[model samples]
Target: MLINCVAYQEGKKLADIPIEDISEYLSHPKCFVWVALRDASPEELATMKEEFGLHELAVEDALRGKQRPKIEEYGDSLFAVIQTVEPHGDELTVGEVAVFVGANYVLSVRRDAQQGLVGVRARAEREPHLLSIGSAFVLYALMDAIVDRYFPIVDALEAELEIIEEKMFASGAGAQRDNIERLYELKRKGLVLRHAVMPLLDAMGRLYGGRVPVLVENCQEYFRDVHDHLARILGRLDSVRDTIGTAIQVNLSMVAIDDSEVNKRLAAYAAIFAVFTAFAGVWGMNFEYMPELKWHYGYHMAICSMVIVCGYMYYKFRKSGWL
Candidate 1:
């Protein structure tokens, strides 16, 4: 669906133009058209391809709608695919935005992404000097907006990691289990963010320094800023992943410790009972020649001996912290 199609010249808005008028606006000097689409159909994409003279391969990738985040050059024009990430309950929902940027036009096709780039256009209009730089500026603005959104998600991931860490050693039958599950969930979200950021980081890096795309060559600084933002996000993502790894290991260790404690108590009790059983078994074997069996106090004596030995063993186990 077409969200908006507007024309601009010399850093200012001219008017909202019909789709047919896009080519007409492009013919004028210092003018360009910016178009936004949401889940565009194949027919709409084909129309856009004709209007912008977009490369067929680029159009096909956009139509497919789940291309890996990347930047490709087709002569003087640039095509970019960036992933959009949003937090959905305990999981992260992934989306895509395909951007076709030329000297005089920008076509942004969004797929499966809930957030719109309206604010980016507004921000660009507010700063006419930057908008006047042409389609490159618009591309930067859109990327900046998308990259900025990742900050909040990083914050959320960090916040969740801290919460889990605080409860890492919490005492309960299910505490460690719950934390391990949550850490793995958190790790999965981090991986989603990593998959989104890493490719863009590599793609954006090419827009600045050394060899650069002609369309964005003049706006290298802006692209560099974007590259820096991606780098920051990547760093934080790595940290979050590492912390999650350590947290999971710690939770596992806690589980092991609890199991060991249980085994120690069971072994201690078994040892004490084994001693009592040994004494009872020996006395139960009646031998006619056994002198103690003839004494009237023999039964009491044997009972007393068993009680004394079991009591001593119980005391030793308790003092050693085994019981």
Candidate 2:
């Protein structure tokens, strides 16, 4: 769907023009048209291709959707695919925005993305001086907006990890299974973020310094700021992933410790019962010639001996912290 098609000249909004008039605006030396679309139809893409003289391969990638986040150059124009990530319950919803930027036009096609770049256009209009730099400025604005959204997600992930860690430690050997499951889920979310940020981090590096793209040459500083933001996010994401791994291991260790304590308790009980069983078995043999069987206090002596021996063994077990 076509969200908006507007033309601009000399850092100011001229008017909201129809798509057909885009070519007319392109003819002017200092004018450019900005277009936004959401889940555009194939027909709309073909029309855009003809109107803007977009490269066929770029159009195909946009039409196909799900292109890896990247930036490709087609002559003086640039095609960039940026992934849009949003937190959805416990999962991250991944989306894509394909941007076609030329010297005089910028066309953004958003696919499977809930949020739109409408605010970007508003902010650009509010700052005419930066918008005056032409399509490159718009590209940077769109990318910056997308990259800025990543901060909140990273913050949320950090908060979640802290919560899980606190609960796991506080409960100490309790609910270990649940803690491990939550940690793994948190790790999955981090992976989603990694998938979104890493590729773009690499892609953004090319826009600044040492033979940059012609369209973004004048606006390298803005793009560099964006690159820095991506780097920060990537760093935080790596930290979260590493902490999650550690948390998972700790939870498993707690489980193992709990199991070991249970086994020790069981072994201690078995040893105490074994002493009584041994005494009872020897007495139950009932040898007719056994002298103790004829003694009047023989039963009392056997009972007292068993009690004394069992008590000593129990004391030892308790002292060793095994019972």
| lDDT, candidate 2, 211-263, per-residue tens | 89888999999999999999999999999999998889888988888888889
Judged by TM-score, which candidate is best? 1
lDDT (10s digit) by residue, model 1, range 1-323: 99999999989999999999999999999999999999999999999999999999999999998889999999999999999999787778999999999999999999999999999999999999989999999999999999999999999999989999999999864899999999998988999989999989988878999999888888999999999999999999999999999989889999998888889999988988887899889888999998888999999998898889889989998999888
Off by over 4 Å in 2: 170-174
Once superposed on the true structure, which residue ranges of model 1 sit more than 4 Å away at CA?
A: none
Q: Which candidate's lDDT is highest?
A: 1
Error of 2 at 112 (Å): 0.6
Query: By TM-score, how accurate is candidate 2?
Result: 0.96
